[model samples]
Target chain A: MNMNFLLLLLDGLKGTVILSLLTFLVGGTAGFIVALSRLSPFAPLRIAAQLWTQVVQGIPLLVIMGIVYFGPAIYGIFAVPPLIAATIAMAIWASAYLGEIWYGCLRSVNKPQWEAAECLGLTRWQRMSRVILPQALRLAIPPTVGFMVIIVKNTSISSLVVGYAELSYNAKVINNSSFEPFLYFGLAGLFYFLVCYPLSVQARALERKLNVANR
Target chain B: MSPIVEMRELRKSFGAVDVLKGVTFDVERGQVAAIIGQSGSGKSTALRCIDHLEKINGGELTVCGHALHTDKPDLAALRKDVGIVFQGYNLFPHLTVGQNITMAPKLVHRRSRKEADEIGREMIAKVGLADRWDYYPEQLSGGQQQRVAIARSLAMQPKLMLFDEVTSALDPKLTGEVLRVMEKLASEGMTMILVTHEMQFARNVADKVIYMRDGRVHEMGGPEILSQPSTPELADFVNEEF
Candidate 1:
């Protein structure tokens, strides 16, 4: 493999890392709202959130990326930068999965906690903020971190559509020139493994900590 | 004795089934009132309605001289004055015992952390749980957790306290410890409404004992109600244990 090709691989590493961080931060926030909406007492909000998750989850990531890449220009809108499109696409994807993860966490809180909060005379908002969210956050932490690793890995697919120059995109560029499929692809896979393995480990560790504490 | 809590012709139903049907009761200040009944008799529902946990379908409930659901009852404020301890000891699992005790005061009352912490420790100590201040709910035994829950309510400095079969989740040995905490609270002249099956606890502690059957107050009195029980329902309930 050429030295220039390896450098491209390194640039892809930067893209993957930056995009994953942005998705986790921005997408995690968006997902929290979506989760809350999905769990809303109002039927319309719940349906809207549920439909959004369903639609997002059902479509292929590649299709979503294409729509994200090209859909905005249909209204004579300004074109999105490649990085922005990738980030937006990944964030939307993260919101759907994270929303589902968090909703399950919120539901898993003990039933008695709700009744106890109600009896304490907590208003609905107070009950959620003070009593419910704190506990839900604990339950949510492990799965959320775990999902973040998935988000990081899936961002690789952005190479196909956005021209984002992420790890996979750079690897493709290098592979085109080198024609050495095994070496470059394996290196790309190694880059991904390097980025994701520690997060996977951290998430599992946190989950074990939660389980032991709960026990 | 002047009534502090009054429920008149109160009605509540879930879907098509009636849980409370024209139920009425009055609780006096500084009095310990225990509603004793079999499961599903609406004893717990009555307590819940008094605390406004269950929305009433029709009728009136006044707590500490204020009408519930009038002009959108400041629920947080009402809750501060009316504290409830549940059967499951619903202490917030993520928060420490001190945090659980201080949550209402700090959030609802806007007490400073320092003030809330100081008071939380005091309440925990009062319940004999000072050592468990930093412990989470899951760390403590069932009885210890219930005592901490009672302390959590006490931290609110409530005018009225409700216990919904608080000892039901505990073993017989642990039951006495929790009941003793209640006994102490009652001796301190706190107005309390307890829904419990512990006949001896009711006979010994309650200023008023109400025997509920099928959502209505079937019979009521002091120790005399327990001693001279006449109705077959009450007789059957009393005989089951004695």
Candidate 2:
């Protein structure tokens, strides 16, 4: 209810947004590469990518944050910032899930399309870029937008280990000082909803629009 | 003159089953050859092997002067000279008909956008879908989509075209439209090889007819071979409703 409390929450919200965007940008690029490698013709490359996804998905995110934050110091590089450490951990976590999601989307493209492109004499890259990727990207959009909500929520975990001071962290601080748990926590929840609701709506809209078979 | 496509004792096996067992055939320049047979007779497999869509296990195979029996054939160059259309009409659903037709010419041939669009329009007109150039594959009927698919292949100016049951998915009315376009291509002196169920189209349009049975050329001759098949397999295949 107080101005100072509101300002603290808003400041934390900014950090949350920045962290999510940065993690997604880094993670999304890495995920795309992983997805391509999973589908690569070479057995070793595909196995390597598959191993990465399996290992990343197997570990917990909080543990990943701790290791990333502390793993550098074990090597005698002690200058690692909390924000950088948290971002690195979150990115690794996200790329595994996103890579799997995108790999499924890429595979969902009909087999005949690949054949058609092959018969046209398009190179391997051309078949992917001109035919396979375009269709896969359309199918990928809805799930990708839905994944953004997960990214926004997951940023909160960074605050637990590294104390990155995102919305949840600030809410805990405000509640401890004022002893008004309901007010601060409710306000934090509202901020999270405001950030995530639009993405959910957009994802649903894309699912309907891209469902061309029914149309 | 050398044939556009020549297969001498070509063999292909999927696991334990042999699909194309020592199939021998030739498709000459400016000739239309139709391979007709019952299902599972390897007519489609033979067509796919010509485009190098299916790798051959043994024997000699050549298309557009490129030998395919080698470990590393120049597939890109071979494909550039050869075009293929499938029964499914695998037009990129996300792209418009014009975009689909112009993709190869622009990318593979490196044609300018203006030149590609010009070629797109010409091929679209050739298939009687000039007005539907901007439509997506899903927006068109099954037959129209197949026509657009044909145009997409034709835009590359291939030396030879292969069609694998291209009209098998269509109703009789729609099939007529597609067969008419193919008939026109035959009259224009374009070399083509088609695996079709439409015996009437084969008799009317194909200069040569091949009847495949159990992965071999059972009977092959001029269009009259349909009416007067020398072998019982060819006679049974020609008389069947499929």
* Every candidate's CA RMSD: 1.9, 1.4
User: How much is the lDDT of residue B180 in candidate 2?
Assistant: 94
- In model 1, pairs of residues that clash are A12-A167
Clashing pairs in 2: none
Error of 1 at B156 (Å): 0.9
Query: Model 2, A130-179: lDDT tens per residue?
Result: 99998899889999999999999989988888888889889988998999
Candidate 1 TM-score to native: 0.95
- The TM-score, computed over Cα atoms with residue i paired to residue i, of candidate 2 is 0.97
Each model's DockQ?
0.65, 0.90
TM-score of chain B of each: 0.96, 0.98
Classify candidate 2 by CAPRI docking class. Answer: high
Instruction: Kindly list the per-residue Cα lDDT of model 1 for residues A1-215, writing each as its tens digit.
Output: 57888888898899899999998888888889999998789999999999999999998888888999999977679899998998899888888999999989988888889888776666678888888898888888888888878888898889999989899888888888788889999999998998789989999999999888776
Tens-digit lDDT string for candidate 2 (B1-242): 99988999999999999998899999899999999887898999999999988989999999999999999999989999999999999999989999999999999999999999999999999999999988888889999999999999999999999999999899999999999999999999999999998999899889999988899998899999888888887887778843
TM-score for each predicted model, relative to the true structure: 0.95, 0.97
